[model samples]
Target: MTVAEIFPWQQVLWQQIRQPENLKRHHALLLKGRKGIGKLGFAFGLTQSVLCGQVDAAGVACGKCQDCYWFEQGLHPNFRLLEPEALSAPGGAAGKENEEGRVEAAGTKSGKKPSQQITIAQIRSLDDFIYLSAHQARDKVVLIHPAEAMNTAAANALLKKLEEPPEGVLFILVAHGASLIPATVLSRCRQIAMPAPEHKLARDWLVRQGITDPDFRLAISGFSPLLALQHDEQQSAPHADFIQSLCVPEKFDPIGLAEKLHKQDLSSVTSWLQKWCYDLMSSRISGRVRYHLQQADSIKRQAALMNPVAVGFMWRNLAASQQLARHPLNSRLFLEELFLTYGELIRPVGSETR
Candidate 1:
């Protein structure tokens, strides 16, 4: 999407970035925001617009221009997108149009896993790309998404470039967590804080995307409209079942629930469970739930009967579990343990049975 076609919430920010005169003042730009807020997308849009041979008054690329065509086809010589090998795959968001160097299709070494980090090799290759003048005589643009994915070596290599950036070169780093970036690297860039839109604006945007109960989806996504739409389409059913199980103590079926969720994505399940537990604490003390607004009433009712201290303890456990969620030896067993713990916490006020 072009800057002109960006989300309503992003228009103001885009305008600040779209001005070529304004862009020349900074060599490195950090687009930092929470997940699902389209930080990477905004960075890409601005990159395209800036590199376009022709642009509208809003600094939107004209699809008819040569540079714009090269960008859309992922063949722009002066443009480089550095991301995990997976995201740069032919079908990946980084460059779905690129048929070469697709990580999944490229395969990995024996007993070695495909790396998700931006490697030093990838960073070093830019030495050639950046040293040369722009093919379009505009600017050499390097986009690194989720810059936190870079390990120490890769970050150090990138830091060198940031420290001595070539003229007419722009480095755009899209990070969801700014703290993950090296202090040396972060100090050299211009930080742009991307805030989430207001509740009504987020909900209305979700509605425009064809989501029913926009507020519910918005709440589930932490008010990120893009994530709300994505979750509603991809994960609504499983998420609903999981949330419902936690909200109603009587409906708690630990074994069956564990088996049901065991086959799902363990990481996502872990996040959902953590959010559910967090809401329990929120409901107990604050009479509100942040992530699951739809379940606030039920959460509050259950929270009233539960011990707040116990709820707080469970929340911490869930948070720790999230750290190692992807490395579970057995998903079903892990879920069983989690559900069992939750079952004990929510056991009826007087009964001993789970």
Candidate 2:
């Protein structure tokens, strides 16, 4: 993808990448942002640009160059993409162990055994790759997507290499949240913060990608185009329905809602909750709520009834829940607790019953 097509924030980042002076001292670079903002794509593109045999005026890699061709074909010896073995698991972090306290490898789509994390063993393997003379005698690029996925030991192992990287070697670390990374890791690298896209721009991009529903765009993604594409209308319908049910002044069923959500994957539940909070936040600000358009009147009424401070408080709780769900948490209990919190938030103040 062209730099302009990547994301607005990425285009700004490309300016820094294009200047050789900017690359002088920084060997390890960390690009961090929210998911679906194209951090990984930007990392890959940056790597290819650095290794490309031919570059255009914009300093973008010429697609037909040998290096670019090999990269596209996944045959570039000088380029490496490192991630946790379970590619689909969020942020590539290890999942919880089973009843016996034995950690299972994360599941892979190819049915290959899951790897616990990007282990020190994997980091050591890179030494063999990098220690060799540069493939093209130009630059050797290693793109470590979701660098935070490295376990503590693995991160420390990688840190040693980062401290004294081989000549002509470049390491790009991509993470959604840099807080997960250790302070040592943060200090060693030059950080590139990829901000979220503009809401209207992202919406237009999503519409071009065939997401036509305005409500869908607003609900699923506040300002990230990549996230907008990941949400499916079919899956979002139930979430909207659940919110509608809660908007009414009636007994809400937290257990039933949690069960329904448990049927879906953890990522979907997190996304739904994130979107729901955004919708509520938007409703509070705009005095218009369209996430559940059919229940707009009810939502408006509920929004009016709730205290703004409490709503803000609930938003923070939901964010915490999202992070907690990432690692080993009782999914059922987590959902139950979240919904119960929501129930309490929407309940009439000083009510004896919720």
Candidate 3:
């Protein structure tokens, strides 16, 4: 891995952040935003530029100098990347352009699932890296991706470092859920709420990546171009089937649908329903559907007959379901109940014939 390229949508913020004054003022930066919009890539690019022996007037790494060469080869003595073991595995999301960089493959325990949380041991082990003399007497950087993955012990350990700043060191923490981070930790870093590109910009980027019907892909993936690409490449068929089941709520089999989709990522499954329900509600109120662009006519017809109060309540209830989706004891049972509730909301008593 070479340096991560900053996306077109990120140009303005990139320039703003790359300013010498901004870099000098903040020793640590918390880059927080929705996932799949290149927050990791931005962090990676910033790391490279900071360590570059020859940075351009634009503050981008020249990629031709010794420091840049070592960084690309993952041998930069002054730089370290901290990420979960799962993400460092071969063929993991870390390998993708949308979410790049894994300094080295993490050692996995045989027959055991790789740990997801950043361990206290990992944070503690950073003392030498932080306090030691730099390889070239330059600034050292430590990047923690998905910083929300830090467990309580790990976070507390990191807080110690943040509380007493280390000279000549920079910390870049990338996170999708900033709320999960402890308040004290949050307060210590310069928090940057990363931007998502506008619909047109996102759709154009997806189209350039060879995604057909970019509007629907963009909408379904919450307007994130990288996510839209992932969805199109990985989940198009399953997502279409899921949407089809939702389109005909009266005839759909919640049990069967749940069985089919239970093996999938529950969080993603919940989001699909959330977006679909949102479209149903939006279509009824504003005569428009947001996520399911190709299914607008069906949504309009269904929304017209549905009880608005019931739909609203169900939509609100999905928020709680989303939380449970993360740690459901029984995936199939959880999804079955979810679909059954949606069924009731869409075709409540005396509303089917309306």
Candidate 4:
């Protein structure tokens, strides 16, 4: 599918993609953004746009052409899509287990598990693919999703290719955080920053999808429409109620709240916390609040009582808690510490004296 078909917001980016003048000197392009924002989709569309033998005046691929048809069927020799094999999910066959175990063992020797890191074997295979002649199109396109999954060695190996890439080849690296990549990799490609959609735009998109809840909009303001939909379904009902309770300090229980959150997915939990903070900042600044506005009074009260630096420190702690959640840890204790720290940060300084 075309970029426009994948994401309506991509029209702006597609305009630039269509301009031949804009394409010069950037054979390797990095598209960096959070997950579920259609970065991979965009990269795929750009691949088709570049490789399509027939193109319309609007610069969109003619989907009916042989090249597009092959691409649609995953038979196109010119297009390569690579992702971590761990993403395939676990269980099923013994053979599958053996294969995965071997890959994982190889990965571990290289300092990371296969599920955690894309191995050097995977990166080396790209060289063979890129060196071969394209079957139909003028260029060969390689799209690497979550490129940060490459281990240090794998990343370095890929860097050598990026430094002196073959002619008529394009490398598209999709990353959630560009900071994870080496400076050499960062310097080799054109960087495209894809920020989250505007709140109103996200809300409108959600409404079109039949989700009209104000709470849902508040919970996912800065996320893409796809992620908002997922969160609306996956975020626990109790979690929703708990977030609402932030408005009423009497209902807040640091340990109990932490216990609840510890059961949820790390990415979703961190996303919710980030969006909540963004909403709090909006309430503090614009007085035009969306979700969790009932907590506005408490938020403002605490904001006034605490030093601004201390408040910033609390945010930093929240981010750290989220990051720490990524690795293996005692979820209960970790979350308890996080919420207790939050409670301490929000409590009035002189309440003990009273």
Candidate number of the best TM-score? 1
Model 2's TM-score against the true structure:
0.78
Clash counts for the predictions, in order: 0, 0, 0, 0
Tens digits of per-residue lDDT for model 1 on 202-304? 8888778777788777777777776676673456688788987786688789999999888876667777877887888888777788998767898888888
After superposition, candidate 4 runs with Cα above 4 Å error:
1-6, 21-25, 33-36, 73-75, 88-114, 195-200, 218-223, 259-262, 274-295, 327-329
Per-candidate TM-score against the hidden true structure: 0.89, 0.78, 0.86, 0.78
> Any residue pairs clashing in model 1, and if so which?
none
Q: Over the full model, what C-alpha lDDT does candidate 1 score relative to the true structure?
A: 0.78
Report the C-alpha displacement of residue 137, candidate 3, in angstroms: 0.7
**Model 1 vs. true fold: TM:** 0.89
Lowest-sum lDDT 10-residue window in model 2: 94-103
Better of 1 and 4 by lDDT: 1
Score residue 251 of candidate 2 by CA lDDT: 68
After the best TM-score superposition of candidate 3, give how far the Cα of residue 173 lies from its true spot, in angstroms: 1.1
TM-score ranking of the models: 1, 3, 2, 4
Name the candidate, 2 or 4, with the larger TM-score value. Answer: 2
Q: List the residue pairs that clash in candidate 4.
A: none
lDDT string for model 3 (189-258, tens) is 9999999898888888878877778887777766777767766346667888999887776678889999
Q: Find the 10 residues in a row with the least total lDDT in model 3.
A: 97-106
TM-score of 3: 0.86
Stretches of candidate 3 above 4 Å error?
A: 1-3, 95-107, 232-234, 259-267, 284-288, 307-313, 316-334, 351-354
Instruction: Name model 1 segments beyond 4 Å from true.
Output: 1-5, 90-111, 232-234, 348-354
